[model samples]
Target: MKRVASTLHQGALLGLLCIPVAQAATGDAGSDAGTQASPTLKAVTVTATRREESLQKVPVAVTVLDGETLERDNRNNVSSIVQEIPTLNYRPSASNKDSSLFVRGIGTISTSPGVEPSVATVVDGVVYARPGQSTLDLLDVDRIEVLRGPQGTLFGKNASAGVLNIVTRDIPEQTHGYVDYAHYGGGDENRLRFGIGGRLSDTLKGSLTTSVGRYDGNVENVTNGHEVNGYERKGVRGKLEFQPRDDLKLTLIGDYSDGENDTPSVVVKPSAAVAAGISPVVPGNSNRKISSDYKTYVDDRNQGLSLQADWSLANDFTLTSITAWRGWNNSQYQDNDNLAALPVTAVHDKGTVDYDQLSQEVRLTSPKGQFVEYVLGTYLFHGKSDETYRRLSVTNSVGNTGVADYSATNDSYAVFGESTFNFRSDLRGIFGLRYTLDQIEYDHRRVSTSAVEVNSIRPSYASSGSHTDSGISGRVGLQYDLSDNLTSYITYSRGYKGPAYNVYFNMQATDVQPLDPETSNTWEVGLKSSAWSNRLTANLALFHSKYENYQANFYDVVGTSVVTRLINAGSVTSQGVELDYALQATRQLKLSGSLAYTQARIDQFACPSGAAASCDINGKPLPFTPDWKSFVRADYDIPLDNGLDVELGTDYSWQSKVQYSLDQNPNSEEGAYGIWNASVGLADYSKGWRVALVGKNLADKAYAPVLSTGTSTTRIVPRDDRRYFGVQLHKDF
Candidate 1:
C-alpha cells in the first residue's frame, strides 16, 4: 500500500516541474487590462564565493532568497524558509537544542555536544557553533544564501554538507523606519515587527530591528483544559558603524532573544496507544490533538555580539577581521509517555543546557579582475557547554530514575585559502584547501535518587575523556562560459569532520572511548543558463557523495528495552538532481519553481555492540529524506491609475513520504503531502504602506514532521497542520 502511494506522489512531482517554464516563455500576461512589453528578470548578486558575483556566474549550487521575497512568502525564520528550497530539510525536536538542519539528506542527528553539525550557519561575519541558534527569529535580514555540498575550503569549520550564509540589512544612509503587523485566525497567532535605520553622525551610522509574537497553538490537550503547542517569543537586533577613513570601515552587531514554547509536539497515535492498552487516537488521526498528563515547555534565551572591520590595502587588496561572542541557555520539560493516564511503563524528562562560544577570524583577498584571485584566512573558535537531565519513569512501579550531568569543551584552529585562475576570457579554474586541528573534552556522571531502588534507562556511571585530531580538505573545479548567457562547471571536493564522543546523560563505562572522525568525497556537475533575452533563468546540478565513518544512532536491545546510542556507521551514500528556474513572463507576472530527486541510503551498517545477529539495515533509506520534493511559486501585480499596486501570489510545496526514524520502523513514516499558500495585497509605493490577506495550508492538510515511539508514539505536528488565514499591515517612514 505504501509503495503505491509513493509511486503516485512521484508522478505528481514530475508533473509539476516538467510543465511550467515552457508556458512561461510565451510571455502570458496576468491581467487582461494590459498590452505591455515583456520584462527581463532582474540580475541577482550573491556572496557564495566569499565575494560579490553574479549568481549565474558562480560555479556552485546556491539558492538565494532576498528580503522582499521572504516577506511576500511570509517566511520569518530558518525553519519556514527551508520548506521551499530543494534538498534542504529541517527537523524539530522536543527542545530547540535537539533540532537540526540537513542538505541533500546529509546531516547529524546526535545532540551529544561532542559532535559538530555537518551543516553550519554563518550570520553576517559570525559562524554559529550550534545550528539551533539560527532559529532565533532573525531581524531585518537582507538575504539568505543556501550553498549546497561541501564548502570546506572557504567556509572552514566543518561545513561538510552545506552552509547557510545569512546577511543582515545594512544601515541606511538617511533616516528610515518601518512597521509590520500580522494576525492569523486559525491558530490565533499574532506578530508585530518594526525597524529603524539612519545616519547617527558624520562618520557613523546605526540601525535597530525588533520582533514580538504569540500563538494560542493549534492542538488541544485532552488531559488538561488548556491548549497545547503554543509559543510566546520576542527578540531585538541592532547595529552600529564607524568610518574613520574611506579605505577602512568598522561595524558592530548585537542581538538578543527570549521565548517559551511547548515541546515540538508529543501527540500520541491512537492505534499505538490502544495496542499498549490505552484509549483515543488512530495511527493516522487527523484531529490535531494530544493526550498528556504533564504539561511540556521549553524556556530559551540567546544573545550575541560581533565586530567586523574591512580595510583596503595597497595594490587594491583588502583585509578583513571578525570577532564574535555568543551564548545560549535553555530548559526543557517533556511528557515523554504521551498518554492521558499513566501506564505501567511511562516516563517524564527534564533537561537544561548552558552554552557559549567565542571566535576570531582574519582574512585577506586579492583584487578582482586580476589573472588570479585568492582568499586566505585563519579561524579560531572556542566553545563550552554543560547539560543536566533528570527523568522519572514507571516499569512495574514508579521510580525517580536518575539525574545525569555532563560538560563539554571544543577548540578549533584552521587556515584556509581558495584561488581562481582565469586561464582565458571565458574559462576559469578553481582550487582551494584547508587544514584544521580540533581538540574536544567531556566529563559525564549519572546517579539515581529514588527510594524505590536503582531504576533507570542505563546503569549509573561516571566517565571522563579527551580527544585531539587534525586533517586537510579541499576542492578542485572548472568553469566555462558556453555562451554569453550560459555556463557549465564540474567539481570534486573532500570534506572532513573531527572525532566525536557520545557524551550524553547515560554515560556508561563502555562509552569512554571516542568515535573516529567522519569524512566524505563528493562530485558535482552543473549548468547555468539564461534565455528569452535574459527574461528566463534555468539551472541544474547533479551531485553524488560517499561518506565514511558516518556518525549516526544505533540501538541496544537490553532485557526487552531498546536503548539508543550514538555510533559511527560503516558507510553511507547520497546522490541527487536539482532543478531551479525563474521566468518573468510579463511586466507584472513572475514564475519560479524547483525540483529535487534525492537517493540517500546506507551502504554499510555497523551493528550495536553485542547486537550483531539482530541488526540488518544496510540498504535502508535515510530518515527525514524524501525521494522527491518540489515547489512552485507565482507572483503578479496590476498597477492602478492612481499609483496603487494590487498584488497576488501563490506557492505550492510538495514532498514524497518520509521516514522519521533511523531504525526504519514503518509506523514512523509520514505520507506524502502538499501545502498551498496564497496571498493578496494592496500597496502604495510612494506612501510606503501595504496591506495583505494570507492563507496557509488552504486545503487543510494534516501531517507530522517528527515522530518517536517507545511505550507510546509521540509526533510533532507542524505549524501548518490545518488551514489558517492572516491579515498583514505594513507602513514605512
Candidate 2:
C-alpha cells in the first residue's frame, strides 16, 4: 500500500513537468516595458517594502542574485545554490527533502519532520512552511533577496533570524519566452526547460514553465549490487495576472514537483557492526551499515498554490494580500550506513506535511515631498500545518516492533508594523514592532502488529501557549555622500527570535528541559564606496551580537532519541568583520573577492545531567560554524570580431574548521577544503542567445556536510564530490 501511494504521487509530479510551455497564454503588453531601459550595476528591489527602490538607496544589509547569475552557476536547486553564498550552510539528510540552513551561526538541527525552520523562505508572496518543500526547482526567476538582519516587523513568524525572498518574473506584458537545455558528461545527466509569458489581453497575462533532469548517483552501492544513490527530478509551474483597474492587480501562482531516487540509509557504524555480529572499524574511518536486509530508497513530492493582490486605494495608501497552500510527502528507507564492509541493520522512516497560510497587510505612506516620509502598516498572518511521521527498526539481530507514529497540528498568527522618519535627508531613523500568537498540538501513538491494536505509551497532549513579545527592532543609519562615486554609512540595530512550540513539546517528551524564549541584540557599523570610474567597489562591515536565554538540544545517554532543552547559557558573544571588493582590471576583465572572519562561543552553559564539573564545549566554537571563510571569482571576456564573444570565469570558496557535534568529537570536525568552478560562454547580449560550458566542484573533493551525535561517531551525509562537464544553451524569442 505504501509503495503504491508513492508511485502514484511520483507519477502525478512527472505529469506536471511534461506539460508543454508553449501551450500557455502569452498575450501581455508590458512584457518588454523595461528591456530598453538603461542597465546599472545594481537593480531595483521591492521586497524590503511594498514599493520598488534602488538597492543602493535601501538602508538594509542584503545580498542580491539576478537571473543571469543563477543560470551561469547552473544551480537549479535552492539547497545546492546557497552553498556559494557566505554565512549560509546546508546539512544534508536522507529522511527529509529539504536541508537545514544556518545563518550567522544560528539555526535548527532536527529530523523530527514537524519542527518549523528558524530561517524563512518566501517565494513570490507566500511563506513556505518547511525548508524542504520551500526549495523546489526555481522557474522564471527574476531576482533573489537575502536580508541579513532580523526582519521581525516585515516578515513576522520564523523571521527570528533573517529572510530569503524570491521573486519570479511577472508575466511579461509583451510576448516573450525562452527554451534552455543542458547535457552533463560523467554523471549520465540531461536537463531541459522552457517557459513562455505574455498578455492574453489588456487586463490579463499568464505564464507556464516546466523542467526535467536526470542524473546518476555518484556513489557505488555495493549492498544493492548496483548504483543506489542518484536521482531524477521533474517540475512545472503556472502563473496568471489579472488587473481589473489601474489601482488593483492580482496574481495567482501554482507549482508542483516530483522526484524518485535511491539513497544510502545512514546509521551508527559501531552500533550497526555490533548488531550485525561484525567487528567495529575505527571511529570516523569505518564504513558499516546499520541494516543490510533492505536497501534505501527515497520518494519526494511537492505542490503549492498562492494568490497575491495589490490594491492602491489612495495616492499614499495601499493594501496587499497573500494566500498560500502547500503540501509535501517524503519517504525513505536505508541500510543506515555508508559502507557494507561489515554486517548491518536497516531502518525505515516516512512522513507527510500539509500546510495553509493567509496573510493581509495595509500600509499608509506619506507622499514623496513630505518631511515626514513614513511607512505605517498593519499585518495579520495565519498558518495551519499538519504533519505525520512513522518509524520502523529492523535488523538481523533485532526484530521489527511494527511502527511508532507521531503527528502534530500547528496554527499561528501575527500582527506587525514599521515606520521611518527622515529627521534630515542624511540622517534617517526607523522603528518597528511585531505581536504574535501560536498554538501547537501533538498526537503520539504506537501500533502493535500481533493484535493489530494501537496502544498509547503517551497520552495525547493538546496545549495552547501564547507569547506577546514586543521589541523595538529598528536601525539608525546615516549616509554621507563623499563624492559622486563614493558613499559611506554607519548603522546600529537590535533583533530578536520569538519563542517556539518545539521547545515545550520537546521538553514534555525528553530528558532535556526547556526554558524561556531566546533573544539577541546586535550592533553593526559599515562603510561602502564606489570609485575609479564606477569600476572599483568596496564594502566593509564590523558587527557584534550578544545572545541570551540560548537554546540547546542534546541526545540522551542511550542516544536513541533527542532531548529538547534550554539554558540561560550565560551570555555568548559573536564579533565578526567582512570585506567585499570588486575591481574591473580592464574593459574585458573583472576580479571580485570577499573575506569573512567570525568568532562565536558559549560563555557559560551547564552540563546535560548537571553533574560534571568540566564539559565538552564550555568555551569552544559553536558547532557547524566556520571561523574564517573567503570567496574569489574572476571573469574575462576575450576580444573577438564578427559579433562573436568568448568569456571565461572561475570561482573558489574555502572555509576553516567547523565542529560537527556538541560532544566535541575531534574525528567529526570538518577540515579546511575548497572546490574550483569555471565556465566558458559565447554570443553577445544584443542577440539574446548564448551558450556556455560549465564545471562545478572540479576537484571532486570528498567531505561530509553534517553528522549525528551518538555514543559512537556515525551517520555521515557525504557531499556530492563528482565532476560534470555540461553545455548550456539559452535563447529568447
Candidate 3:
C-alpha cells in the first residue's frame, strides 16, 4: 500500500500553487510534492457537508455540478440537471407544477397538494418545503451538492432520504459581475442570465441576478384554432451581505420565479382507462376540450426571502442563526386524455406559507489541553400555511362548478446536543440526542355546486393535534490513518422524521387518525484514497437502510367523493453500492465517472391487492426503483497560439427500466435508455470571457423524462428528439 495524502490536504496544496509558475519558480515544498496542476479542473465545491471542505476530500458521497458545466450542457431546466445525476427520478402530478423528485428509491408520486416530500432541498440554509420550488432554475449558484442518504441529524425535517443543497455565490469583496445570453435553434429556446456584485464598503457587499427564458410551442394546437404551444419563464434573485466586524457576518437574500409551460399532452391508452373504470376520450376533440386547456399550459410562481447570521464567539466556538419566509402559487390544467370523450378537469391552486425559524447553536472545540469537543443547539419554528385547491368540472369547456380548500398550521421546537471524544489517536466516538415537540392544527373544507343540488354541501372539520417524539441519533466511527493521505471508516446512525399534516380534497371522518412519522436506521462503511502521483482519486461506499411504517397513498374501498388516502405500510429495506473516480490522464486531459447499484423494495407490503388472480406483488421491486444507473463525463481543453482555446467534452447516462406505477401495470415500466450530450467551445482561460456551442440529445433520442399516470389517461411526453444546437456568450466586468 502506498501512502496518500488526504483529499483536503491535496486541495489546499493546489490552491497554494496559484497558476503553478510561482511555486515552480520558488521550488516551494508544496510544489515539489507531486502531480502537476490541470487547467480543466478549476471549479471548486464545498457542499459535501455543513463545513467548507473541498469536493474531493468530502467524506460523504456527493455530486458537484458547477454553473459552467450547467451552461456548457445547455441545461437550463430541472430535467437537464437530473440527466447528469443518474440516481434521481421524478413523476408529474396535478398537485406540483414540476415533477416530484425521488432519490435512491424514496419520493412522493402523488401530486396531491397535501402530500409532503420525503427529500429536503436547502438553499443557503433555508429549507424549501414545496415540491414546486425544488425545480426552480439555478440562480447565481456557486455550487450544488446532492448528499445521498439520511441527513436528518444535520439538515432536519424531510431529509430522511437525502438533501439537495443549493449554495449561492457569496458577494465578493472586490468589484466583479457577469452577463450571459444564449439562443437555441429548435423550439426557439432563448435564455438570458446576468448578475452584478461589488463591495460598497470594506464591510458591505451586495449582488443581484435575473434570468429569463422563453420559447414558442413546438407542437401545434390543431383544435384550438391557433398555435397552442411553447413556454415563457422569468426569474430573479438578489442578495446582500453586511459584515460590520471580522468576527460577525449577516446576509439577506430574496428570489422570485414565474413561468408558463406549453408542453403538449400524451393521449391516454384504452387499456389503462378501462382498468380505472373510466370511459375513453372521444375522438376528434382537442386536448383542451377533452381534459381542459389548463393541463396543456402550466402557470407557476414562487417567492422567498431569508436571512442568515454567523457570530464567532471565540476561537473555539461559534454561533449561527437562520430565518426565512417562502410562498408558492401554481395554476395548471391536466388534459386527462387527448380525446374529448371524458369531461375535462381544470384545477387552480392558491397557497400562502410563512415560516419564522430561529436557531441558536454554540460549537466549542478542544483547546490546547481540552479533550472534549461539544455542540449544543436550540431550534424554534413557527409556520402558518393556508392552501386552497379549486377543482372545476368543465363540460363543453365550461367554467368551474365546484371548489376544494385545504389548510394547516404547525409549531415546532427542539433542543439537541452532541459531543465527540478523542478516545484514541486512531478512533473517535460521536454521540448525540434531540427532543422535539410539535403542534399542528388542520382544517379541511369542501363545497360543491351543481344543478342537481339546489344548495351546495359545505362539509368542514378541524382538529388540534400534538405529538412529542424524542429520539437519540449518533455515529460511531474508527479512522485508522495508514498514512497522511489514506484513511477508512465505518459508521451507523438512526434517525426519525416527525409526522406532518395531510390535506385531503374531501372531508375525513373525525374518527380517522392521521398518518404517523417514519423511522429509519442506516449502516454504512466507506474508504477515501488518492494515489498515482496525486492524479487519481477514488471513493467507495456501501450502505443499508431499514424503514418502518412508511406512508403511502391508497384508495379507500368505502370512501366517497375522495379518491385516495394516506396510510402507513409495514416495512421496507434498501441497500446500495456507490463508486466515484476522477483521474487526470494528463495536464490537459481529465476523466470522471460515477456508478450506483441500488436495490430498494417492499420487504412486506400489503396494498388493497384487488381481487385479481394474476396480480401478485408479494415480492416485487418497489415502484420507480432503477437497479443500475451510471454517469461518465470527460473534457479536454487544447490551448492554441494567441489567447484562444478549444475545449471538447461529452457525457452519457444509462438507466435500467423500473416500475412507474403502483398498480403494477406491465406497460408502466420505462425501458432502459441512454442519452449522449456533447459540447465544444473557444475561450481565453486567462481572461473572464468565452463562447461555446452546446448540443443536447445529439442522437435525438425520444424518451419520456417522466411518465404521467394521473387518472385513466396515461400520457407520455414524446420528449423532443430533435437536435438543439445553441450558442452561449459570457463576459465578466
Candidate 4:
C-alpha cells in the first residue's frame, strides 16, 4: 500500500509541474480582461446517461475516441483498442472461443455460454450478450465511448464493471460514397479491407464493408517444418437505413465472418521436479518455437442479423425497439499431452450456439431549460439460447468422449428515472434509480461413450432448473461549474449482475448448481477543464469500488476429470485514478496522453473445489490487473505549396507487470513491456484521394499476452507479431 501511495504522489507532482510549462507556452494568465476572444473547443456530445449531453457535463468518467483517432491508431478491432485504453485488457484463452475483458480488475474469467460478462458491450444501442460477439472487427465507426466504474442505472444488467458503447456511421442525406483499401506486410502477414457507402434513394441509404486477412505463423514446428499457428479470416457487413417519415427511422444490419487456423502454439515450461523426468523447452532460446506431432486446427463461423426502429414522440420523448439474432460455431483439434515424441493423449472439441433477443424501451424527457430536467423510461428484454459441446479424448488406443447440450430462456424488465435539479446557475444535483427483475430457465444433458467400468463411475446426467432474481440500482451526484472553462463533480453509484447457471456441466446432475448474483458500490470524483483558449483540455477521475458476492470461475476436479464451475466469492475492493489530456499546441501539431493507476485486491476468498490447497487469498491482486498504465500520442500536419498535405503521427504505450491467474503463481507472471507505432501519410482533399503508410511495433518488442500453469507443465502464449508496415488508400466520389 505504501509503495502504491508513493507512486501516486510522484505522478501527481509530475502532473503539477506540467501545468507551468503549458501556461508558459499558451499564456494562461492573460485572459483576465476577457477582451480577446479565444477559439472554442470542439464540442463533444455523448449518450452515456441515456440522453444526449455534453461529455464535460455528464458527471461520469468516460473516454471518447472519434473515428479519425481510431483510424490513426490502427484500432480496427477490440483487441487492438485495448492497447490504448488504460483500464481495459483483452486476454484470449487457448480455446480462442472465449475472450476475457478486464476493466479495473473487475471482470469475469469464465467463458461459459450461460455466464454474463461484467463489462457490457453495446453497439448502436444494441447490447451483445456474449463476449465472443463483442470481438467483431470495427468498421465505419463514428465514435466509441468507454465509461469507467459501475453503470447499472442506465446501461441495464451485467454492467457492474463498466460499459463499452460503439456508434457506427449513420446514413447521410446526400448521395455520396467512398472507397478504401489497405495492404499490410512483414512478419509474414497480409490484410486487405474495403468499403463503400451512399444514399440509395431520397429516403434510403446503405453501406457494404468487407475484409480478408492472413498471417503466416511466426513459430515453427521442428518436427514437421511447418507453421503451427497460421490462419486466415474474412468478414462482410451490410447495413440499410429507411426514413419513411420525419419522426420515424428504421435500420437493418446483416453480417457474417469465417476463419480457420492452426491450433495455437503453446510452449511447455515444466517445473524442476517435473523437468527431471522430461525435457524442458525455453521460449527465447529457440526463437520462441515449439513442436507438435499432431496435425491440429481450429475453425470458427459467426453470423448475425438485427433490426432497429426509433420514433420521436410528443413532449420531447422517444420510443426505441431492437431485435437481433446471432449464431456461432467453432471446432478445435489438439494434442493435450504437448509432446513431440508420441501422441499420449489427443482431443477434439466442437461447440455451436444460437441466440435471439428482442428489446423495447420507451423514454419521456422534459425540456432542458426547466428548473428540473427529468427522464423516465421502461425497458423489456426477452432472449433464448441453445448450445452443444462435444469432446473426444484418446490414450493407449482407448477413447473417451462426451457430449453436453445446454439451453436457456431469459426475460427481464426494468423501470428507471433520472432527474437533474438546477438549484442555481452554477450548481446542480442529480439522482437516478432503476428497478429490475430477471427470470432464467436452464436445461442440460450429458452423454458419454466409454468402457463399462468408466461409464459406471461417470454416467450420463441430465438436469433442469429455473431461477428468478430482482434488484435495485441507482446513482446520486452533484456537479458544480467552477467557471466557464472548468467543472467538477462527485458521484455515488450502485451496480448489479443477475444470477447465472454453470454452462460447462458434464458430471452428475447434482453438481450443476446456480451461482448467486453480484453487486458493487462505487464512489467517484472528477474534474474536467478546458484552458488556454480551448487549445488544451484535461480530465481527471478518482474512484473506489466495493463488491459483494463476486462471481468467480475455477477448475474443479470431479472424480478423475477437471471441469469449470462458477461460485460466489466473498468480497473485493478496487481503487484507481485516471488522467486524460489533449493539447493543440499549434496549428500544425497536436498532442494527447493518458495515465491510470489501480490497486485491486481480493478482500476475502476461499479456495474452490479443485484448488491445490484450501487457502485464503485475502490481499492478493486480481489477475491481469496492472498497477500502472500510460500512453502518449502526437500528430503533425504540413501543407505544401502544391495543395498537398503531409501528416506524421506516432503512439507509445506501456503497462506494469501483471499476474495471469487467481492463485498469483510466480511462474504465471508476465513482465512489463512497451510498444511504439508510427505512420506517415499524404492527402489531396481537393482531388478526393489519399494514401498513408503505417507501421506497428516499430521497436519489435516481444511479450506474452496469456500464460497458465498446469499440474506438470506451464503453457505460454507469446505474441510474435514483432513489426509490421502497411499502406492504405482512399477515394471519395
Number of the predicted model whose lDDT against the real structure is largest: 1
**TM-score of model 2 (CA atoms):** 0.83
lDDT of 2 by residue, 1-733 (tens): 6378446634533332222111122222133322444222332465665457755556566666666678668777666655566666666666455366666666666544334565678887567766777656777788888766566666645465567788888788898888898887765667889899899998999999998988775544444446545678899999999999998899899999988766554443355534343233233332422323455666778888878787776665666776667777766564433334332333344555555555554555545655555555555555555555444443453434344445545455555665566666555555566655555445544453334211111223333333333334544556554443444556555555544444232223432222345667767666555444344556566677777766545443212333334433445666676666666666678887766666777776656563222365667776677877777889888868778789999998888778866556675577777778899999776777889999977987755666654424544434345566789898888
Task: Name the lDDT value of residue 733 in candidate 3.
Answer: 81
lDDT (C-alpha) at residue 558 in model 1: 35
Which residue segments of model 4 deviate by more than 4 Å?
A: 1-42, 228-230, 261-265, 271-287, 293-298, 340-343, 450-459, 505-510, 558-563, 711-720
Q: What lDDT score belongs to each candidate, Candidate 1 first?
A: 0.82, 0.60, 0.61, 0.73
Q: How accurate is candidate 2 locally (lDDT)?
A: 0.60
- Stretches of model 1 off by over 4 angstroms after superposition: 1-38, 268-283, 342-345, 450-456, 557-561, 610-614
Write the residue-wise lDDT of candidate 3 on 1-733 in tens digits: 1124234434533432232333334544243345445322343557444556565544466776676677667666555577677566666543344366777777655443334567778888777766677766778876678877766545544366777787888887788888898988766878898889989887889999999988764445444434344568899998989999987889988899988775555443444433333223342111221233333556777788877787877654657677777777666664433333434323333333322233333223233224555555665655555555554444445544445565665655666655556676645555556666656666666666653321112233344444444444444555454444444566676756566545654444621355577777878776665554455566666788888877655544321121444556557777887666676777677888766767877776655332221235545666667877778889887989997889898888777777775545664667777888788888885798889988877887656554433344343443244567888888888
TM-scores of the candidates in the order shown: 0.93, 0.83, 0.84, 0.90
Report the error of model 4 at residue 84, Å.
0.5
Candidate 1 at residue 527, lDDT?
Answer: 81
Tens digits of lDDT, candidate 1, 1-733:
7588557645744443333343345554244423335478889898888888999999999988887678656687888887789689988886878888889998888778898988899999688888767777778988999999988787746688899998988899999999999898876889999999999888999999999989888777765657767789999999999998999999999999999887535544544444344234434546566666777889999999999999999998999999999999989898766665565655688999899999999989999999999999999999999999988777665555778999999999999999999999899999999999999999998886643333346656788889999988899999998766668899999988888888887667667889888899999998887766566787888999999999877765433445567788779999988888898887799999888888999999877675523357788888889988888999999999999999999999999889877778776788898999999999997999999999999998987777775544567767888898999999999
Model 3 ranges off by over 4 Å? 1-47, 77-79, 94-98, 111-115, 156-158, 225-230, 263-265, 271-295, 341-375, 394-400, 417-426, 450-474, 555-563, 608-615, 710-713, 716-721
Highest TM-score, which number? 1
Q: Counting only residues 3 or more apart in sequence or on different chains, how many pairs clash (N, Cα, C under 3 Å) in candidate 4?
A: 0
Candidate 4 pairs with clashing backbones = none
TM-score, predicted candidate 3 vs. hidden true structure: 0.84
Tell me which of candidates 1 and 3 scores higher on TM-score.
1
